[model samples]
Target chain A: MAVNESLRVLRTIHYDEHHYSLFVSAGTIGPKTKPGHFAMIQAGEGFRPYLRRAFSIADVTKVAGVPALEFVVKIVGVGTAALARFAEGTPLPVLGPLGVPFPIDDLLPSDRVALVAGGIGLAPLVLLARTLAARGIAADLFYGGRNENDVLKRADFERFLGPHRCRYATDDGSLGRRGRVTELFTNALAGGVRYRRVYACGPVAMFRALAELLAEAKLEGSFAMESEMACGFGVCLGCVVPMVDGRFATICKEGPCVSPAQIDWARL
Target chain B: MTVDLSTAFGRLRLKNPIGTASGTFGYGLEFAHYLDLAALGAISVKGLSFRPCHGNPPPRICETDAGMLNAIGLQNVGVDAFLAEKLPELARLGATVIANVWGDTEDDYVAVVERIGSDRRVAAIEVNVSCPNVVKGGMIFGNNPEALAALVKRIRAATGHPLVVKLSPNVTDIVACAHAAVDAGADALSLINTLVGLAIDLERREPKIGFTTGGLSGPAIRPVALRMVWEVRKAIPKIPIFGMGGIETVEHVVEFLIAGANAVQIGTANFRDPSLASRLVGELAAWCEDHGVARVSDLVDTLRTRPRPDHEFA
Candidate 1:
């Protein structure tokens, strides 16, 4: 069940030159918020960029005793660029908290799980990391970015899972290790870091690569996928992902988070 | 005082002049959490075919200026699965279900309607002849007047349910298509299904959508839809018209009705606001009251066109 909320922008926090965090006043969105669920945000007031853009629920916190929702947005196109320019107290019409959330209940405290994210993909994984921490589960975080600016929320991840438990990699060698995030993941696997389950959110290519890696390692994991969505419900059928079972699943309803076995990598 | 929002399309009567457009409203059960299902005038489900369709590959959708393009390829669980899994839920909800049927061939269309022919829950059968994604019998049947008429007549004989022919705007003369459907025994008409369009990813140096082309929908196509509906109404005076294209607000609904549509369907707007159709119902009633109109149906085809001036002849 989703509800439309006219929330006001409480504040904006710039993580870097291009990345920012929008903290909005969450009316009823607080109690309904879940990890991997997103809001269909109207970029601006008119129909120029007609369709609403989907953003993951990055963080939920209280501002001056009032519940607020935070979204980590990267300015890539007209829709995101419009959202990036909003000032404090700007009214934002949002329809959410939508899509199937990550399966956090399936993991036990003793389970050694790894939370992997690429670039802006860290948005949803951060919330999942916080939830895992609250459950007394100490999961490791492996984040990869193009550079230091791309890995926008390193402090937030370190705060959730201490500095030692968090790892980083960058393609440009401006951050921790000079390589792709998957290389860090492969290194961890090679060092006898036996992860019981892996949870990831990133680009489709990354998911495809991770799917093959997980298959070779005989490990199980889930992925939070992104698609060009119209309605964040089952009706539009606009955000469909092919399944391994020769069927198509709507990313909005059946997933935003799907197990590796559900996706047909060959088709993707 | 309660306003009479009830509307009729041949023998099929709706409680209001508002309904969800096909492919936008899924079986009327998905939005159950947002609004009351039975309160809607009608619920048009996703397009169904003789066999289950996997749809097109990924990158099937992309956003354009003031609209979106999608080549979903009419994905659905065949007619049997629809009747078995979805019809019961619609029946229990007491909704006027308008099953949108499509196919790759004429026989496929007839077969789907025949399978759903006797279902008491199905209020109407909407023939989708305008899909632009598939490589088969979609737009081919819709673009030609003779082919459209022949297909509609075949399906008309196969079902007892009221037939609503959904037309395409991609054609040069949409009015001819509308007339052809009515002449072939169509009970009503709905238009315009998305206009064929293409979008490109300049960075990738390739087409944005996987199918290379898809149907363009949303507010961008609304004006074209309104004109086509107006033209069809002038061409055929008696048939009911269900107008849809980029309709987002109550004002857009009024514009459609004034343009000669008996009813209007909310398409892409459903994605932005799941409760929009139900909300528009209330807003429409309020608007009718504010404008001193007793019934919403009275507003249809009331556009006052000015007569040609005599100075041109002189």
Candidate 2:
């Protein structure tokens, strides 16, 4: 089968300026997507923007008797801007449940799954939080953004969380905590918050800082990375992360989600 | 419903003729994530030189109408690192690896082939003579048949790998260069690397590519590619030709074969769809079986579009 597949946009909802989440309808992969996996979304068809942008699958559910996928995309480039400005019913060229997902079974039953997110990175953590809750596993989520406006779907996160464990951080101190999300991490650890597994997802610089903070505390964690991909399936040699072994590895093929131990973070 | 993408250059069989060109596939190991290694016929890694290069910096690439312009300057990890790090990975991936070798001097070219000759996985060696993005060594050997034949003769002495000399489309007479390379003992030929072309951005009052101009590739280059393939096939009859440039679909593959290409390579298209090669394989099979074409090889030199030059196949 050709790795290239197209999806019909079930709906597109603009949450705020520069941020919108689309409900996409995919065939084979709709039911199988876990929290950490991403789908490569392209707005145009042939003679396209040519490449699709990678977005973490925010959540998946049966919508209106049809299996549907949700992509929480923050408009950044020409592709996302065009998609964001597009009408709700336009067909979206999408490919893959690309990249490795989080090891859901790896977390111990009693262990806390700490989700550290920055801004739009909250989408995957929110979905992961819900997945963990459904499995009867507890998770602590620290969702951060530039301000309250950037922190999307607060009610959705809180409502689904339902006493699961959640916190908020804004860079401008516009909402919950008066500082960065990393501050919340320091506060959580200082207050004796015990976690068996820590998963961090956000910008490369932010993740690098969090990786360092987690390392200094002698805590192990997994990080989800971002790479500009041609074919999210890895046919284009564009997306490559130099591994610890000095050989380059593709983020789309090896992982968007990888253990910090595997990355040569300095090269990133 | 089956596509026979397998192609032959002399007796060497390639499972699929959809591999990338030299300097385009980046040592062939980079696409492992997007594909199953053993699936394709072969991978032609980027052009490697004796000394390491920084490659042209950012703005090395620009989007053209149906394709793109790239002045990567053949940035490679030198010959030794390729054998030590890149080749093992290519070997593990299970493709018939073809290393595209380049050099600043004649001795440099021979050294690259010598080191690669030891690799059991290297199925063929492509001598890149047409790289326009670089200044000193690339365009020199390719435009002049004497220089190209001399280089081919030296490398032919260095190793016994299937030697394929890649021609530059920018040259006035590509057929002459093809004949020279073959006369120097080259087993096969590939043409033409990106045509030397330029696009200008009116708004910025600047050339579209950073290097002022770069190799043109993509759908836009197809007609020219096909013509050159036909011309070269006319130049050297019975010798295998690896035709490429802007090929995306199976129909495009058919066009190249009809133009006298024994095999073909997929470039630029990989940037759009990673699975395009595999899909083309499927499409080629169906087209053949449906047409009662017994062997895919029969498509080569079948176009008969132009009057054959005197001495073609003589």
Best by lDDT: 1
State the lDDT of candidate 1 residue by residue for B172-280, as single tens digits. 9998899899999999999999999999988898999999999999999999999999999888988999999999999999999999999999998888788889999
Itemize residue pairs with steric clashes in candidate 2.
Answer: A234-B34, A235-B34, B2-B285, B3-B285, B15-B41, B16-B41, B27-B46, B260-B301
- Docking class for model 2 is incorrect
What are the per-residue Cα lDDT tens digits for candidate 1 across A50-93? 88889998988877887898899988888888888888899988
Task: Please provide, for model 2 over A1-268, each residue's C-alpha lDDT reduced to its tens digit, 9 standing for 90 to 100.
Answer: 2234667777777888789878877666666677788887766765445555788888886567767888788887577776776654577766667788887777767777688888888767767877887777777778788888888877766666664477888888888897888888889999987778788888877788788878778787877777666556644434566677765566777888888877777866
Query: For model 1, how many clashes?
Result: 1
Per-candidate DockQ vs. reference: 0.76, 0.14
CA shift of A247, model 1, Å: 1.7
Q: Which runs of model 1 end up more than 4 angstroms from their true locations?
A: B308-314
Looking at model 2, residue A246 earns an lDDT score of: 64
Tens-digit lDDT track of model 2 for B199-230: 88788999866678888888889999999999
TM-score of structure candidate 2: 0.75
Residue B313 of model 1 has an lDDT of 65
Per-model TM-score of chain A alone?
0.96, 0.92
Name the docking class for model 1: medium
Best by DockQ: 1
Off by over 4 Å in 2: A1-6, A82-94, A162-164, A171-174, A192-194, A242-247, A261-267, B1-123, B128-150, B168-180, B194-217, B220-239, B258-260, B282-314
Q: Which consecutive 10 residues in model 1 chain A have the weakest lDDT in total?
A: A42-51
